[model samples]
Target: MNKTLIVATLALTLGTTAADAKTRLLVNCFWPSSHFACSEVLPAWIDEVERVTEGRVTGIIPPKSVAPPPDQVAAVQKGIADVSVMFNGFFGESVTGPLVAMQPFVGSNSAEAMSRALWRTNREFFADEIDTVQLLSQFVISPAELYSQTDTPMNSIEDLAGRKMWVLPGPLAEIAKKLGSGVVSSPAVSSNEIISRGVVDGHLGLDPQAVQAFQLMPYTKSTTAFSTPIYSTSFSVFANSDKWAELSPEDQEAIMSVSGEALAAAFGARWDKAAAAAVAAYPEAGIEVVEADPAFEAALTEAAAFVTEGWLKAAADAGMDGQGVLDFYTSQLAQ
Candidate 1:
């Protein structure tokens, strides 16, 4: 008998059923159980995997996430969990490739398009950077808009001078510094407390849905909506390489067929809807959403050059064609 069959016989002798012989994948979800990723995306993906594989593969969520957000990639790579999704920037300098998606004003306003573009770009140009884990998909969320807690909206570059704003580390902080704004570096979880206590005058890098999610909407007086998004976060759904190798070739193909760009599009579309709904409800919460005027656009155009150049320099350090990636991304979004 073949070694594979022999192993199966041995496993059956150990009192495991035939159904138990199927490969089981454990998805370590970092978001809260109530979060959309946990409540919807994972479940739907699991269903599709099962259906496509004819029950040869199945997936389950753990009682809780195995690791925090920043540790998710390592957790999956080391096999602490078989699968997980994580934001690109949360890992800091260790991650590469997804940086292209995080750039300001490069993506389509349509999250679905941006998400698909990210997947395609990563596959074409940066797969080596993320080969530690098996990538199932890549995606970008809806772009974030700037919000101010005060009644006076920030409309121009001059308006940002000396104004304190909470910014997550990355391009946003760099942009804030370039504009001569005081930067208050804080994680998203702590933003509510910091902003509520007036520790900062406003914040950048969150969409309307996030503002509501973080309870910033109640405190926000006006939102400065840029024609292009100020920035978007990149995310990946991935699996442990060792775990992936254990699956049958057919099962692997089945799982992959339903993942990647397909899953990315789903995530992007859902996020876009949530952001739109949140923006629609802003007036009921007594917050004004202001579109950026020509002057403000001119200033943003000038300010973005610095952050973009910095990203390109960093990309070059990583031995990547930063400009090529950016150009490709723009063309993809334009489509």
Candidate 2:
């Protein structure tokens, strides 16, 4: 072959090698495309992962979620997708650690504090329960609150009698039932339809941004805010363990450097901003937001105690120091 032909062949091989060197990961986002989780956090994290790895690895989210919110964990674990974000409570008895964050009144107003605390708590106590997947990060979104379409604000326990309240799964629902509220349950994605169609009188456990996202403001007449949130939803970004193992150790290290608590903090901070913006726009949307009265608060405190006691009992049965873990998480928030 001529010298020019040899040079051209070498260039073609080099180009092919360069293309094969890039690792592209597909993220099966559970949140809607319009949600900040999909719209902001996921993309930002993807960019960070690629940048930190010096372009060795990159991630892409589909224009729409490949799996429903509750099914994401299963989808990723079964290798139907390489990555996913899952809500721990949605899996029922299958996973346990995220319950620490889901515990009523256990979270702070500061999403960053709650998220980082949950990350630390998971590291210390919940790893075994979550060992099925490679955890990229853990987060507690906004603290939970109630929004009602009612004649008057929900100011006391008496006001809850027989009123329909949409409750998320787990302790929050249990608490609502114990308080004499008629519980209607549905996922956050369907909240707008549920309320708009008068399927339920109100929802019990969504953050302000979620409420706004679902366009719940028009149907919701009153929002009862607690001194501390009623509950928080725990979310985790994870990858299929097999897929995660395929990455080079250096790439894994580079990706993780931008994950864990730092990733959680960034997600939490964005959630806070979204919640604040949603809450700020409430009046313009004609929704009445009110603080829970002291009497109502006392009742909530009693209900929280009941729920926490149940959780602690369950934790002890699992050979974990439930109160100790809770105390440590709360302490971390103070710092």
Among all candidates shown, the one with the greatest lDDT: 1
Residue 283, candidate 2: how far off, in angstroms? 1.5
Q: Which residue pairs in candidate 1 collide?
A: none
Off by over 4 Å in 2: 1-20
lDDT of each residue in 212-317, candidate 2, tens digit only? 8878888888888888888888788899899899889999999989999989999999999999999899889888878889788888778768878877887888
Overlapping backbone residue pairs in candidate 2 total 0
TM-score, cand. 2 vs. native? 0.91
Pairs that clash in candidate 2:
none
Question: Model 1, 109-189: lDDT tens per residue?
Answer: 778899999988887778768778888998998888888888899888877775899987777888898889999987777
Per-model TM-score, in order, reads 0.92, 0.91
Q: Whole-model lDDT, candidate 2?
A: 0.84
Q: List the candidate 1 regions with Cα displacement exceeding 4 Å.
A: 1-20
